[model samples]
Target: MTVIRCPGLLNCDVVEVPHGLRLLAADGRSYLLRGLSADRLAEGPLPAPLAHALDRLGLLRAGPTRTVAVVGSGRLAIDVAEALRGVPGTVVAELSDDPATERPGGSWQLMEDHSPSRLTPDLVVICPTDPLGLRPVLQLCRERRVPAMMAWCGPASAWSGPVLTESRPGCQNCLDMAMARRDPLWLATAAGLTGAASCWAGRSWIAGQVAGLVAAGCDEAAWAQPTWASWTPRGHSSAPLDPHPECWWCCQSGPAPVRAESECSAVSSSAA
Candidate 1:
C-alpha cells in the first residue's frame, strides 16, 4: 500500500487521481479500484508530476478554444467536466432526454432542449448507456457531419481505436463487435451498469479514462502524441469487407445487390 499526497488537490474542488484513492479509506473500495493502468507502477515509486499535468492539461484543454459543453451527466461526461475544470469551456450535464437519451449536439445549442442548427460540433462526446442513445445520435452525427467520437465504456469483442469522425476504421461498429465476442463476466455485475450512479466504481473509472481519450482526441495537440490506449486487453479477429455488395455507409462505390430468399438482414462485418 503506497500513497502520495497530491499538491494539485489544493486547487481543484476534489483530490486528483492516483492520490484520491487514499482518501477512499475503505480497503475494498481501494482494492477494486487499484492497478487498472495498462502500464505497471512500482510501489512507493516517486509519483510523476501527474497531478500537475492533470490539473493543467486534461480533457478540456485538449479541445477547441470554443466553449465545450459536456452533454450528459453519465460518468464520462461528469469526469470530463471534472478533469477540465478552469480550462476555459462551459460544461453542462443537461442533455438527458427523459432519462437515458441525450439530445444529440445539445452542446452546440448550449442547451439540452434546443437542437443545434447542425452537428458541426468542434467536439461532441457520446456516453450512451445503451444502443438507444448510441444509434440515434451516431446516425444524426453522421447526417450533420459532426466530427464526433464515442466513449469506450465496457469490454468489447474486437474493440476499435479512438472513435473518430474522420475515419471509418476507428468507429463504434467495431467496438460493438468486440462486445459481442466477450464473455459475460466482463459485464462485471447485473449492476455492471444499473444506472448513472450505481455502476461499479471500477467501471466509472474506466469510462472516465476513455472519456479522457475522447477529450484529448478533440484537441489536435494531445492526439498528435498518440497517447490514448485501450482500457482493457482485447482479442483480435479478422473482419474483412464483404466480397458481396454492401450498405451505403461501408461500401460507397457499390450498392448492395438484392439478397436471395432467407438472406434476411445484411450480414454485419463482424460475421465477415
Candidate 2:
C-alpha cells in the first residue's frame, strides 16, 4: 500500500491499474493516464501523465450575479451587501424598516419596508442575525414570486449557507424542516442562543464565504447551485439542498411568473 500527499497540490492514492497509473482524487474521482506525447508533457519532475492529471483537477469556477436585494438590519446583512461591491452591474440594496429615515449609501440602495413589491431583482438575500426570524421575509419573497437565499451567522464562529435558494428546489420552510429533522432540539437551542446574544459572533471569513455564494446566486451564474455550507475545524464542506415533496410553502406557490422587461424595468423605482 502506497500513498502520496502534496500539500496544496493533490491528495490521492497511487495505484497500479490495468491501464497503467491512475490517480484517485480525494473527491472520489479517478483519473487515468495512458500515454502522452513528449511535447505535451511539460518539463517538470512529475511525469507527463501525472502532471496532466494535476492540470485537469486544479481550476476554480464560480458564478456571476447582477442585481440583488438584501433584507435584514444586522451586521451579517451589511457584510453581505458590502461584499457585493465592485462587481460590475451588481446592485445591492437594503430594505429599511423606516422609509422616512432611510438614506442611500455608497454602492447600496435603501428601500422602504415593502421594497420587495417594487423591485424584481434577480435574487433576494435575507441575512438575519436570528436565523429563525426570517419567516416574514421568506413569506414575502414567496408571495412576490422571487428567488431568495438565506444565511445564518451565529456565535461559536459557525456559519450555515447562503443556504438554499427559494425557486429551483429548496425553500425556507424546507430548510427549517431539514434543520428540525437533523436536530430535534434545534428550534429550542437556536431560540435560547439567539435570545441571549445581542449580536452574532460569526467570524468574518465564514461570513465572507456565505456572502460570496449569495452574490453569485444573484448573478444567476451557471455554477450557482443551492447548497448548505458549514465550517468545521477540519475545513468547509457543502451539501446540496433538496426539495421536500410535501413542502407546504413551496407546494402552495406556483412558479414565479416571468415579468416582462417593461414591467421589471422600473426595478430601481420607488417602492411607493
Candidate 3:
C-alpha cells in the first residue's frame, strides 16, 4: 500500500529541540519526532513499518481523494463546506436548489444544476435549512446506494446523523415513521411550515459541531450503527435510531411480528 505525508502538514515547520524535532503543522497542531529525520517526511511512498507508525501518529495519509457533495442552503451549509475544505484529500462541491439567494463567504463553486443524476459523490452531507425539501434527494441517494448524512439547525435545536447507506439498518424513512408514531400529528405539522423554518440563529459553534459530525461520517470505516446527535439550548445528546419494523425502505421483507402494547411502549420509552 502506498502512503504519503499528510497534506495538512505539507508546510509544517520543523524545529530542532534538545530531545527531538518538533513539527508545527499548518493546522496549528504540533508533533514530536524522537528519532526520525525531517528528510523522511518527504511526500512519497513510505516503508510499511514507517507508514504504519506515521499513520498512527496522524502524520501520514493514504487512499484516493474523496469527493463530498454538500447539499443545502444558508450560512450553515457554506460553513460546513468551508470546514470540509480543510480536510486533507477532500474535494467539496456545494449544491443548492435556490441559486438566486446570495451566499456570503462562499468561495466554493456553487453547482447551479441540482440534478441528482449529475452527482456521484463518495458521500453526501445534507444540511439544508428545510430538510423536508430534500426528501426527494434522500430517496435518490437510497436508490443509488450512495452514502449520505444530514446535519441541520432548527429554530431551537440542531441535529446530525443516522448516516444512511444501502445496508444500514435505519434510514430517513424510518426516522420519519418513528416521528409520526411518537407524534401522530408530526406529518401534518411539518407540512404547514414553510421555507422560513430553515433559518436559524447562525451560531458558529453549532456549525463546527455539525461539520465535525459530517466529517466523522465520511470515514469509510466508521461504525455502521445508525445514530444521531442532537443539541438544544440546554445541552446535547445522541441516540441510536432503530429501524422501524414497518419501514418500506430498510424492512422490505415485511413488518416484524408486532409486540404487545406494553412492549411497544417500553421500546419507545427507551429510544426516547
Candidate 4:
C-alpha cells in the first residue's frame, strides 16, 4: 500500500532536537520522531512498521485538500472557522447572509452569496446561532445537492449533526419529520422563535466537534454519517438520523423537485 504523511501533518514544523526530530503541529501538539529523518519520511519508501505506526496515529494517510464552506453568523460560526483554519489541507470560507458586513481579522474570506452555484464547496458546515435561520440554507442544499453538516445552540444546549447529503438516507427535512413525529407542534414552536440562543459556555467545545467532523468528512474513506449529538447541562446524547419513510426530501424518486419557498413553508406547517 502507498503511504504518505497525513495531509493534516503537512503544516507541522519539523525541528531537529538533540534526541530526535520534534514535529510541532499547528494545534500545539508535538510528535517526537526518534530514529526517522524528516527527509526520508518525505522522500519515500518508509518501513512497514513505521508506516503502520504513523497511520495508526493519524500522522500518515492520503487525502486531498478540501474546500469547506461555513454558513452562519455569530460566535459559533466564527469559532468553527477559527478551528478549521488550523486544519491543514482544508480551505475554509465563510458564507454570510449579510453582504455588507465582514468579520474583522478573520483568516477566511467572506462570501457574500450563499448560493452553491457561486462557490461549489466540497462540504458546508452550518452552525447558525439561530436554529430557524437554517431553513433557507437547508433548502438551498437540498436544491443544489450539496452536502451539509449543521451545528447549533439551543436555549440551554448545543447540538452537532445529521450530516445531510444527496447520497445519504436522511436529509434535514427528514429531521424535521422526525421532530414532528415526536412533537406534533415542533414546527409551529420553531416558527415562533426569534433571536439566536446563547451558548456562551459550550461554544468552543461544540465548534471543535464541528471542526473535527469537517476534517473527517474530507477523507474519502471517512464519509460522515447522518448522526446527531446534543450537549446539555445534564449530559451528552447522540443517535443516528434515519430517513423518514414519508419524507419528501430523501424518500422521493430522485431529488425532491425544487419547490417555492412558500410551498415549502406550507408543507412544513402542515407537517407540524
The lDDT of each candidate is 0.38, 0.52, 0.60, 0.63
Question: Model 4: clashing residue pairs?
Answer: none
Clashes of each: 7, 3, 0, 0
Per-residue error at 121 for model 1, in Å? 2.1
**Alpha-carbon TM-score of each model against the true structure:** 0.45, 0.56, 0.63, 0.67
Over the stretch 71-105, how does candidate 3's per-residue lDDT look in tens digits?
A: 77766777777776655555777776355754442
Q: In candidate 4, what are the lDDT values of residues 94-165, reduced to their tens digit?
A: 876444646543322323246654666777887665554556666676566667777777667777767677
By the TM-score metric, which is better: model 2 or model 3?
A: 3
> Which candidate comes out best when scored by TM-score?
4
**Candidate 2, which segments miss by more than 4 Å at Cα?**
1-65, 97-117, 160-167, 195-203, 214-224, 232-234, 252-272
**lDDT tens per residue, model 1, 1-272:** 53433222222122225633322322232222243231222232112234223434331123234334344545555554454443333243334423444544334233222355332445555655432244455545555545445543444311223333434433444343334334343233323443434234434454445434543335554433212233334322234322122233334423334655221121232122
Query: Comparing candidate 3 with candidate 4, which one achieves the higher lDDT?
Result: 4
Error of 4 at 104 (Å): 8.0
Candidate number with the higher TM-score (1 or 3): 3
**Runs off by more than 4 Å, candidate 3:** 1-63, 99-118, 197-206, 214-220, 253-272
lDDT of 2 by residue, 1-272 (tens): 43333322234554554535455666787766565322222222243233333655741122244677777666666766666553333577766423353524321232223654556666667766565765556556666666666666665435554333343566555666676667767666766656333333354554466445543334445335556666544466677777655555555556444444321222111111
Model 2 global lDDT (CA atoms, 0 to 1): 0.52
Off-target runs (Cα >4 Å) in candidate 4 are: 1-63, 103-117, 191-193, 219-221, 254-272
Candidates 1 and 2, the one with greater TM-score: 2
- In model 1, which range of ten residues has the least summed lDDT? 263-272
